[model samples]
Target: MHTERSAAAADRHVGDVDLTHWRSRAGRRIAGAWAALGKRYGAMPLLLLTLAVGVGIAVLATWIASEVYDAVREADDVAVLDRPVLDWALTLRSPTGDRLVTWWTDIAGTIGMPIVALGFLVGFTVQRRAWTPLVLLVAASGGSLLMTIAGKDLIGRARPPLSDAVPPYESSPSFPSGHTLNATVIVGTIVYLLLLRQSRVVTRVWTIVVGTLFVLSVGASRVFLGHHWLTDVLAAWALGLAWLALVITAHRLYLTALHRGAEPEPGALGRS
Candidate 1:
């Protein structure tokens, strides 16, 4: 009886070991997958390429738009997208709309993006997880800033002919709007981050919906407030979307790198 009991206990011990081994193997696989994804999306070369391409496109577009401005200077109605829908959007002025526009533009330009970049740094340090998101964020913002200044100087297109309320700030180039670009970066970054963390369809839908609304609102506000022309806003959106695509591509590269055991640096995306 004693021998039989000992044999049964030995069998149970072996089973437990097998179960633990399987669990460990599964955990490692999951970790490996996550690491791979990060590396694939967050590599330095990939991100740099993305930034280069985006800046290059911005330069090209700005130059072309400047040519258009020169040719169309004599036209009284020179707006490209002059639909009533957009015009109505331009005229949507309420005290609340004005306040919201001012608030979002101020926050996005000044604090919101910086804070988000900081959060990515903090999270990366604490969690030792993905850090590529932050890198792309910094690249987008810094590149956008450089491109904006150069474009403004080069293009020098005046703001839209204002018939309604005048902007508090001096209007510069009417080809690409800084406010619109910043809005897209801030909101687009938010959307990309959400895609990273949320896998559920419903959750992603909500995130995208809310994010889109916010971005569009900010862009529209600039036009409505007479701060930017319709073409300027549209150009900004196009440039911002292209930059965002690059970021997403970089993110995928980071994921692949993570799988290869290469850890990314903190604050990769927090360039101010």
Candidate 2:
């Protein structure tokens, strides 16, 4: 009986040890998976981001119909906010307000935006030595430029009438605001890429707020100055946001592939 009791105890102890070991292994596996997912999406879920991209594209489509097809849709209705918004915008006219709006517009312009974006990219790449962000910046800037040009040329939507516009008018098509699009792409990309490296919650929130405010201000300046219709600015917001989201998704996927030790092949969908 004594020998049997001792044998029973030994078996129970061995079983407990095995169970504990398995539990620990399972825990580590689960944690690692979550970590991997976090790395891939910057702590955001992949499904949610993809869904947002889809929504943005849909909104952009509505704008295209309104501007490109001249479809009767509320989204395309320049009159939607024309009278009220323009009336209100006129209230902001003054030497000081004009200066501020012009400053914002100038900074969001082609030359100004590219300088700011490339400057940040150079600094960011220098700090991290990661080819991932460099590739992302190039793609985002190039894609934004191409889209803006194509939209302007193909849509051929005329800018607001000269009577409504302030001085220094633009001659390009006005389906989408170039200043708004450039601002959203450059500011949005900068905030997204930089925020990925920021670990502090407060800092991240502040970064997003500042970026958003800047983009919105640029768009508002365009409308307030009568450069682009409100609808045009809205379309640019949707377009730029969609493009920015796509850029971020690509970057996340790049990070995930890198984490898995995948060899980035030439002429493939990934980079160094």
Candidate 3:
């Protein structure tokens, strides 16, 4: 009877161990599910955070422009250099420089922005049957245009004097350089969408670097050709970066939410 009791106790102990093991496994599974959900929905918070940061930088640019526009309330001695820089640019003019500047400037304007975006937009949509390219183009074009117009009007900071400006003078408020802003958005969007279809890390990196250089060169051309002040270009750069970041981040969050695990490589968006 004692031996029988021992055997029964041992069996009960084994049953308890099994029960504990299953309970632990169930607990771990519940924890893992909660973690996965948190990871998936986490982008919502990230989106809000990015939105705040981007908008904050844009508003900050406006504020800085306001301070600079107020002559008596000048924020720094930097404003003292505006005309000097313009004079230097005017002095640096040459046939070669003029040609280069004109070429670079147009690249961000009628020739480059619209053509590249539209060409890729059609290609991507036809090949992939996805509207992402179109969406990106619209966002970049519409958003940059609206922001440029609104910021210019609100700031009302006059462009450099007509005498100081290059030919085909643009008579618009110049708190933020429209060329710089538009170039950033258009070139940036193209690079981003193209990168989505690419796979080679080196190719991706090189594309980004080249695109960035183009954008920066465009901004410099504006300042060099006396179309805008250094501050105007600076403000445009900051604001444009903010807008681009917002767009890219929002798109990424959208993709993450869609549960598409593997992202397509950057290419022409053709059928794989």
C-alpha RMSD of each candidate structure in angstroms: 12.9, 14.1, 16.0
Q: How does residue 129 of candidate 2 score in lDDT? A: 46
lDDT of 2 by residue, 118-183 (tens): 899898666554444566677677667766776777678777788877888888888778889878
Regions more than 4 Å wrong, model 3 = 1-73, 110-112, 260-272
Winner of 1 and 2 under TM-score:
2
lDDT of each: 0.58, 0.65, 0.65
The list of candidate 2 runs beyond 4 A from truth reads 1-69, 73-76, 264-272
Using alpha carbons, what is the TM-score of model 3?
A: 0.70
Clashes of each: 32, 0, 8
Q: Model 2: how far is 197 from its true place, Å?
A: 1.1
Clashing pairs in 3: 196-265, 196-266, 197-265, 197-266, 197-267, 198-265, 198-266, 198-267
Candidate 3, which ten residues in sequence have the lowest lDDT sum?
A: 1-10
For model 3, how does the per-residue alpha-carbon lDDT over 1-272 read when each residue is reduced to its tens digit? 12211211222222123211224576446334433543555423433444455455555565655555565325656567677788888888998988879887987775677887788788866755544556657766767776787678777878888877778788888878988998888788888776766657788888899999998998888888888998788778877887887777555443433232223322323342
Stretches of candidate 1 off by over 4 Å are 1-54, 61-77, 80-91, 94-97, 111-113, 116-130, 161-163, 257-272
CA lDDT of 103 in candidate 2?
Answer: 76
lDDT value for model 2:
0.65
